[model samples]
Target chain A: MEIFMKHFIRAVLVLVFLILQSTFCQFIKIWDIMPNLVLAYIISLALTSDDIMYAGGFGFAAGLLWDITWGRVFGVRTLLFMYIAILAYRAGEYVYRKNISVCVIFTLVGAVITESIFFAANFILTHNASFWQSFFRTIVPSAAYTAAFQLVIYNLCLKISKMGKERSSSV
Target chain B: MNFFKSKLFIVLAIVTVIIVAFMILSAAFGFGTGPVSNGLNIITTPVQNGIYGIGKGISSFFEGIGKSGQYKGLYDESQKRVTELEAEVREIDTLKNENDRLRALLDFEEREKDKKLVAAQVAASSPDNWYAEIQLNKGTNSGIRKDNVVYTDNGLVGYVTEVGPTWCKVLTVLDINASVGCVVPRSGDTAVAEGDAELAQNSECSMNYISKDATVIVGDSVETSGLGSIYPAGILIGKISSITPELQGLYNKATIKTSVDFKSLREVVVIVG
Candidate 1:
C-alpha cells in the first residue's frame, strides 16, 4: 500500500509538471522546436523508482497524454517512452542515481530517439519522397532544443526529487 | 514475487485503461478539448500576441527607416496601380452583371454571396512538436466554425479547426493534414495542394496530381477550385515556383510559393458562412 501510494503521488506530480511545462514555459517553438521535459522526468523517475513496472506504466501514460494534447501520431510517443524507461533501467544498473550528468545524457539521448522515431513514422505513413528534408528540418532542431533544455530540466528534477525525499523522511 | 505479479498486472491494466479512455474521448470530443487545454490557450494568447507584435514592430521600423527616401515615389506608383485595378474591376463588373442576367433568364439560381468576415489577430502558433497551426482571437461565439476558410489580404491562409468562446485554432495550408483543391490559372490543370514538410526552409506548399503533359510554367497563378466545401472559389493560393514532371509514370508536382507569410502572420480574416 505504501509503495503504491508513493508511486501514485510521484505520477501525479509528474503529470502536473508536464501540464505546466506545456502551458507556462515558452520553451517550445512554432518551428517544432522544444525541450522534452516529460522524457527527462520519466527517465529520472524510472531510474530512481524501486518499482520498474509501475514507472514504465506511468511513462506510457505520459506518452499517451502528450499524443492527445499535442495531436501527434498516436502510439509513436508511447513506444519511444517505453523504450526510454527500459533504457533508464539498464543505465541505472551501471550509473549512480545521484549523477546529474547521467540524467542529462539520458534526456539528450531520449530526445533524439523520440524525434527520430516520430520522423520515421511520418516517413513510412506518408511516404513523403523528401524524407531527409523532414528529418533535417523537424527532427534535428527539435532534438537540439530538447537537449539544451534537458541540461536545465534534468538538474531541476534531481533537486525536486531530493526535496521530496527529504520532506517524506521528515514526515 | 506474488506482490510483483499483482502490481505489474494492476499497473498494466491502469495504463491500458488510460490509453483506451483517451482514444475514446478524442474520438468523441476531438483532442485538445479539455478545460485545461482551453484555459492554457486563453492564458497564452496575450503572450503570443505580444511576441508577434514585437516582431511586426521591429520589421516595420526597419522598413520605414529603409524607405524614408523613396516613400514618395513608391506611394505614387502604388496609387497609379490602384487606379488601374479599379478601372479593370469596373469593366469586369459590367461583364459579370451581363452574365448573371443571362443565367437568370435561363432560370439559374444565383449563388449566395453572404459571408461574415471576422478579422482576428493570431493568438498562438503550433507548439514545437506539432505541425503548422495558428490560434485566432475569434471562435464559436464569434461565429467561427470548423472548416471556415481563413485568409489574409494577400491570399488564402488556412481553415478553422477548433473553436472556443473567444479563440479558434487554424490548421494552416502548410500542415500535412490539410489538403486544398487548387488549379493552375494559366493551364487550368487541377491538383491537390499539400504542405511540403521538405520546403519548410522556404515555408512553401506543393501541388501534386498535375498530369505530365500539363503546360504549367513558373510564376503562373494558383487558386482554390471550390471543389472542397471548406474554401470558396477564386481565392488566391500562390504562384508556381518550380515544377517537377512525372518520373516513373507518377503524376507531376509543383512547388507553390504562398503569398501569406506564415512567419509574419498577424491579422487574418475568417470567412464564416
Candidate 2:
C-alpha cells in the first residue's frame, strides 16, 4: 500500500504538470517564448526516479497528458518524452545522481532533445520546405528558453525528492 | 541471443521501435480523435479553465500593482468611452433593423445573417514554435464541428480540427499545417495562405501561388475568397506584410501578419455551416 501510494502521488504530479503547462505557463512568456514546464517536469521526474521502468512509466503518463491538451500530433509528445525519460535514466546512472548542477545539465539536454524532436516532427508532418531553417530558427531558441527555467525547476525537484526520501526513510 | 535476451536491451528496443512507428503513423495519418484526447479533455476542461482564470487574475493583479494610479484615470476614460459607445451601438442597432426591414421588403439577399456562431473560451495553448494550436472550452455540445471556421472580432483565427464533448481544438493561422484559400482584394490574385513553421516563430504566415504579375503590395488586405468552402467569403485573414520573389520568378510569395492576435486571444466564435 505504501509503495502504491508513492507511485500514485508521482502519477498525480504529472497531471499537475499538464495543468500548469496549459494554463499558468501561458502567461509566463519571455519575449513570447513560454518554457516547456512539462518537459522540465519530465526530466526531473525521470532523474529522481530510481528505476528505468519507473522513469518510462511516469514520462509516458505525463507526455500523453500533454499530448491530449496539446491536441496537435497525438502520441508524439508521448514518444518524445518517454524516449527522453529513458535517456535521462541512462544519463543519471552514469553521472553523479544527487547534485543540483547535474539536474540542470540533464534537464538542459532533455529539453533540447524534446524541442528538437518537436520541431523536426512538425517539419516532417507539415512538409515545410524550410525544415533546416525552422530547426535553426525556432527549435534552438525555444530550447534555450525552456532550458533557462531549469534553475528553479531543478532545485524545486531536488527539494521534493529530498522530502520524499526523508519521508520514505522515516516510514 | 544474449543481447536479445537482455531485459534492458529488449525494453529499449521496443521503446525505440514504438517511437519510430508512432512518428511514421502521425506523419502519414493525422492525430485526429486519437485514443486519449476526448476522455482527457472532458476531465481537464473545467480544471484547466479554473487554472486559466486564476492565472489571468494573478497576472492582472500584478499588472495592476505595477501601474498603480495610472489605471484609475484610464478606467474613468474607459467608462466614459463605454457609455458613448453604448449610445452609438443603440443608434446603430436601430439603423441596422431599419436596413434589414428595407432589405426584406426589397427581397434583397441578406449577408452574414445565416451563419450560426458558437462561442467558446480558450482552455489552453501549445506553447512553443511547433504546431500552434488552441484548445477551446466549448465543443460538440455547442455545435462546433470539424472544419468549422473560428474567428474573432478583428478577423479569422483558424478552424476547428478536433472536437470532443466539451472541448475542441483550434489550429491557429500560425500553424504550418493550417492552409487557407486566400485572395488579395486589390488584385483578385488567388493564393494559398499557410502557417510557416519558420516564420510563425516570428508570428507570421506565408502565402504562395500568387501570380508574378499580380499587384501584390505591402499593407494590402487579404481575405477568404470562399473558394475552399471552409471559410466564408470576405472574412479578413490578414494583411500582406511582404512580397518576395521566389526562384524562377513564376510566382511571388508573401508573408501575412494575421489580424487576430493569437497571443492574447481568449474568446472566439466558431461559424457552424
Candidate 3:
C-alpha cells in the first residue's frame, strides 16, 4: 500500500510536469526555443530516488504520452528516455548529484545526449541536408536552456518527496 | 522502499520500457492498430487543448510586451497590402458575377469547392523541433486528413502529416523535409519553395527552379501556384527576400521571408477536404 501511494504520487507529479512541458514551455520560450521540462523533471527525480525502475516507469509513461501527443514517430521517445535514465543514474552514482554544480553538469550532459540522439534520428529519417545546421543552432541551445531549468525542478522534486515521506510516516 | 533501489528494479524497468517500445515501434512500422491509438488521442486531445490555450495566452502576454516594437513595421506593411487587396477583391467580384451570368446562359453545371476551413489552436510545439512541426487542436474528426494544407491569416504554414480524432500534427514549411509549390505573382514564374536547413533555423525558406529570365526581384510577393492539386491557388507563401545572384543554369533561385511569424504563431486554419 505504501509503495503504491509513493509511485502514484510520483506518477502524478510526472504528469503535471508533462502538461507544463507541453503547454507552459511554449510560452516562456527563449528565442523561439522552449526547454524540455519533462526531460529535466525525470532526470531530477532519478538522481535521488533509489528506485530507478519506478522513475523509469514514470519516464516511460511520460515519454509514451509525449509521443502520442506531439511526436511524428511512435516509440522514439521511449527508447531515448531509457537511455537518459540509465545515464543519469550511472553518472549520479559516481558523482555528487545533490550538489548544484555537479547536478547542473549532469543535467547538461544528459540533455545533450538525449537531444543529440533525437537529432540524429530525425536526420537519418529525413535525410535532410541541413541536419548539422539545425543541430548546432536549435538542438544544442535547447539542451542548455533545459539544463538551466533542472536546478529548480530537481530541488523542487526532492522537497516534494521529502514532504510525502513526512506525511506518510505521520499517518 | 529499499527494494526499489535493488538491481532487480533496474532490470525490471529496462525490460518494461523495451517491451512497450518494441510493440509501439512495430505498430508504427507495421502490423499497426489504428483504433487503439486513435482512441488514446480522443481521450487526451481535449485536455491538452485546454492547457495549450492557457499557454498561448501566457506566451501572447510576454510576446506582446517584448516584441511590440518589432511588429510595428510589419503592421504598417500589412495595412498597405490590405487596402490594395480590397480594391483587387472588388474588381474580381465584378468579374465573377459576369462569369456566372455567362455560365448561366450556357447552362453550365457549377461544381462545389469541396473545401472547408477548420479553425484550430496550436496545441504545442517542442523547442527541440525548432518549430519543424506543430500540433493542432483539430484533427480527423474535424474533417482534417493527412496532407491537408495548414495556413494562417498571414500565409502558408505546412501540411498535416498525422491525424487523430481531435488533434493533428503539421509539418511546417521550415522543416527541411517540407516542400511546397509556389510562384512569384508579379512575374508569373513558377518555382518550388523548399525548406533550407540554414534558413529554416531562422524561419525562412528558399524558392528553387525559377526561370533565369524571370522578372522576380526583391520584395516581390510569392504565392501558391496551385499547379499541384494540394494547396488552393493564390494562397500567399511569402516574398522574395534575396535572389541568388549567380545561377549555374537556365534556372534561378531566391530566399523567401515567410510571412508566418512562427515565434508568435498560435492559431492555424486547416483547409479540410
Candidate 4:
C-alpha cells in the first residue's frame, strides 16, 4: 500500500510538472522555437522508472493527454510515444541515472526519434517527400531547444522521484 | 514478484484506462471548453498581444527617434494618402450597392450569401509540428463551425477543423491534409494546391494537374473554385512562383506562393458558409 501510494503521488507530480511546462517556459525561442515537454516527460519516465510497464504506461498517458490538449490525430502520439518509451527503457539499462550528461544525450536522441516518427507518419499519409527540408528547417531547431532544457527537467524529475522513494521507505 | 503480480498490473491498467478514456472524451466532445483550454487561452492571449505590441512599439520607437526631422513629413504624406484611399473605398462601396440594386431590378436572382465574417485574432502557432495550424479567438458560439473557410483580404488562409466556445483551430492551406482546388486566373488552367512539408518556412505549395499544353506562366494568380464547398468562389489563393513539367506529357506542377503570410497573421476573417 505504501509503495503504491508513493508511485501514485510521483505520477501525479509528473503530470503537474508537465502541465506547467506546457503552459509556461516560453523562453527558448531561437528563430521562434520551443522545446517539446511531452517528449521530455516520456524520456524522464523511461529513465527513472525501473518497471517497463510503468514507463510505457506513463508515456502512453502523457501522449494521450498531449493529443487531447493540443488536438491532433488521436493515436499518432500514442504510437510514437510507446515506441520511444520502450527504446528509452532499453537504453537506460546501459547508463547511470545519476549522470546528467547521459540524460541530456538520451533526450537529444529521443527528440530526434520523436521528430523522425512524426515526419515519417506525415510522409506516409500525405505523400509529401520534402522530408529533408522539414528536417533542416523545423526538426533541428526543435531538437536543439529540447536538449537545452532537458537538464533542468531531468534533474527536477530525479529529485522528485528520490524524495518519493525516501518518503516511502520512511513510511 | 508479488509487487509485479498486484501493484504493477493495477497501475498499468489504471493508466491505460485513463489514456483510453481521455482519447475517447476528446474525440467525441472536443475536449470541451473546459477550464484547461479556457485557461490556456486566457493566459496565452495577453502574451501574444504583448509580443505583438512590443514589436510594434519598438519599431515605431526606432522610427520616431531616428527620423525626428523627416518623420512628420512622411507621416503627413501617408496620412493624406490613407484618407484619400478611405474616401475612394467608401465611394466604391456606394457604387457596389447601387449596382446590386440595379441587378436586383433586372429580375436577376440575387445570391443570398448569408456569411457573417467574424474577425479573429491569432492566438498561437504549432512550430514543432508538421501541421500548420492557427488558434483563433472566435469559436462555436461565434458561429465559427468546422470546415468554415478562413481568410484575410489578401487570400485564402485556411479552414476551421476544430472549434470550442471561445477558440477554434484553423487547419491552414499549408497543412498537409488541406488541399484547395485552385485555378490559374490568366490561363483558366486547373490544379490542386497541396501543402508540402516545408510549410512552416512559409514556402510554396505544389499545384498539380496543370495540363501539359496549358499556358501557365510564373506570376499567374490562383483562386479557389468553390467546388469543394470548403472555400467560397474567387478568393485569392496564391501566385505561381515556379513551374516544373511532369515526366509524362499530361500535366505540370507549379509552386504557388501563398498571399497570406502565415508568420505574421494577426486578424483573420471567417466566412461562415
Q: C-alpha displacement of B28 in model 3, angstroms? A: 8.5
Q: Which regions of candidate 1 fall more than 4 Å away from where they truly are? A: A1-65, A72-90, A120-123, A126-133, A164-171, B1-6, B17-114
- As for candidate 4, its clashing pairs are none
Instruction: State the displacement of the C-alpha of residue A27, model 1, in Å, after optimal TM-score superposition.
Output: 8.8
Task: Compare candidates 2 and 4 on DockQ and give the better one.
Answer: 2
Q: How well is each residue in A78-149 modelled by candidate 1, as lDDT tens digits? A: 656766786686677788867776766776677677777666765556655455665676666666666566
TM-score of 2: 0.83
Please report how far candidate 2 places residue B151 from its true position, in Å: 0.5
**CA RMSD of all predictions:** 9.8, 5.9, 8.3, 8.7
What are the per-residue Cα lDDT tens digits for candidate 2 across A1-171?
A: 555656666677788877787788788876566778778877887777778887887787777777656745567778778888888888898888777677777876777778776766556654846666655665566667777777777766666656456666887
For residues B1-273, what per-residue lDDT tens digits would candidate 1 score against the true structure?
Answer: 685567655765676576667656655665655676566556555655666566567777877687554545645779888667656866898899888767753442222335567879876665445467777877788888888889865688999887777778888888867799998778888889897555644668888898887888999999999887788887788899999886786689899999888776778888886
Candidate 4, residues B130-209, lDDT tens digits: the string is 66776777878788898888887667899987677777888888876679988887888888998875643554677888
Q: Which stretches of candidate 3 lie over 4 Å from their true place?
A: A1-3, A128-132, A167-171, B1-36, B63-115, B211-213, B245-251
Candidate 4 Cα errors over 4 Å, as ranges: A1-34, A45-54, A125-141, A159-171, B1-115
Q: Between which residue pairs do clashes occur in model 3?
A: none
Better of 1 and 4 by TM-score: 1
Report the number of the highest-DockQ candidate. Answer: 2
> Which is the winner by DockQ between candidate 1 and candidate 3?
3
* lDDT of residue A154 for candidate 3: 79
For all predicted structures, in order, the TM-scores are 0.71, 0.83, 0.77, 0.70
